[model samples]
Target: MKLQPSAVGIVVADMAASLAFYRSLGLAVPDEPAPHVEVPFGALRLLLDTEETVASFDPSFTPPTGEGRVGLALECDSPADVDTAYERLVGEGYRGHLAPFDAVWGQRYASVLDPDGVGVDLFAASS
Candidate 1:
């Protein structure tokens, strides 16, 4: 059988923190903690697993170090909305990686870090 893209799984250290981060980004994930939680976004399901969940089967699961090991992006309705989202997240104590700016590529772009220190970008085209 042919293989097609299905899900994106992220092993998180703290379920509550990770869930809060994704929920702030407008994902409909519930504000609950679980060893493994799945959220369906359109066609792809976002799979969240705790450190123990991964290690349960693999036994060799060691969380990778360093920042930006994973990248997630969201597109807003307009350039201004991108700034609003970025500011709101930062205002809530999340780390803002790059302040909102008009990228040379014809889009407003910004970035913020999640609880796991992964960079999540916010971008939108000029309207």
Candidate 2:
């Protein structure tokens, strides 16, 4: 079976807040749709959805309770970008999960949470 990923959907508690956060990161809402925004990350696109919309799939699905429950990892072009992105998230009112640091796997990384409390990791391979 050939498997291809078209999108990654994030169930957000507040669509407006989530959209604003993503837009602050330079993602653009597609012209075709009035509300949804699309952030292209290489081969995949990140799709943000409201709680009500996500409940349509599974009524029992709920937002993560605490830290590190759901994470979205994004690769950066350079280690500096990881630091920059992390700082930007913090400046925009996102709580930092961890400060930017060199990972055991040789990548520089940091994490932040979205409006829905979903974790987002920014990383770049160490040279």
Candidate 3:
């Protein structure tokens, strides 16, 4: 069996706010506005949808409770990239959850929260 991961869906309380927040992080927004938007990132696309839209597909679907913390993990090319990305996120009005720092494991990483309170981690390999 061949399986490939195409997209990851995130439920947001406010579509526009979430879209704007992701766009500021360099993710491309769809040309048209809808309840959902697909953002292309390298070989993968992230599907961003409103909570209502997601619930429509699965009535039993419930968004993770408690601030929707810990959403996505994105890897960067270098430790410097982590710092740069974190800076950009902060500039775009994202709340900085954790400042960029070198981990004991030797990876540089940082965390930020999107408009919907989803945590995104930026990490890069250290040499």
Cα distance off (Å), candidate 1, residue 114: 0.7
Rate residue 69 of model 1 by lDDT: 83
Evaluate residue 33 in candidate 3 and report its C-alpha lDDT on the 0 to 100 scale: 58
lDDT tens per residue, model 2, 4-80: 88988766677677777777666664434323456685588887666677677877977546655667888889999
Candidate 3 per-residue C-alpha lDDT over 61-93 given as tens digits, one digit per residue, 9 for 90 to 100: 887666645478888889999999999889877
Q: Give the TM-score (vs. native) of candidate 1.
A: 0.94
Best TM-score goes to which candidate? Answer: 1
**Alpha carbon lDDT at 73, candidate 3:** 83
Using lDDT, rank the candidates from best to worst.
1, 3, 2
Cα miss at 110, model 2 (Å)?
0.6
How does candidate 2 fare on TM-score? 0.79
Better of 1 and 2 by TM-score: 1
Error in Å for residue 44 of model 1: 0.9
Q: Against the true structure, what is each candidate's TM-score?
A: 0.94, 0.79, 0.82
Count of backbone clashes for each model? 0, 0, 0
Tell me which of candidates 2 and 3 scores higher on lDDT: 3
Model 1 lDDT tens row, 1-127: 9999999888898999999989988898977798999987668888999989999999778986778788878889999999999999999999999999999999999999988888989999976
Model 3: runs farther than 4 Å from truth?
A: 68-70
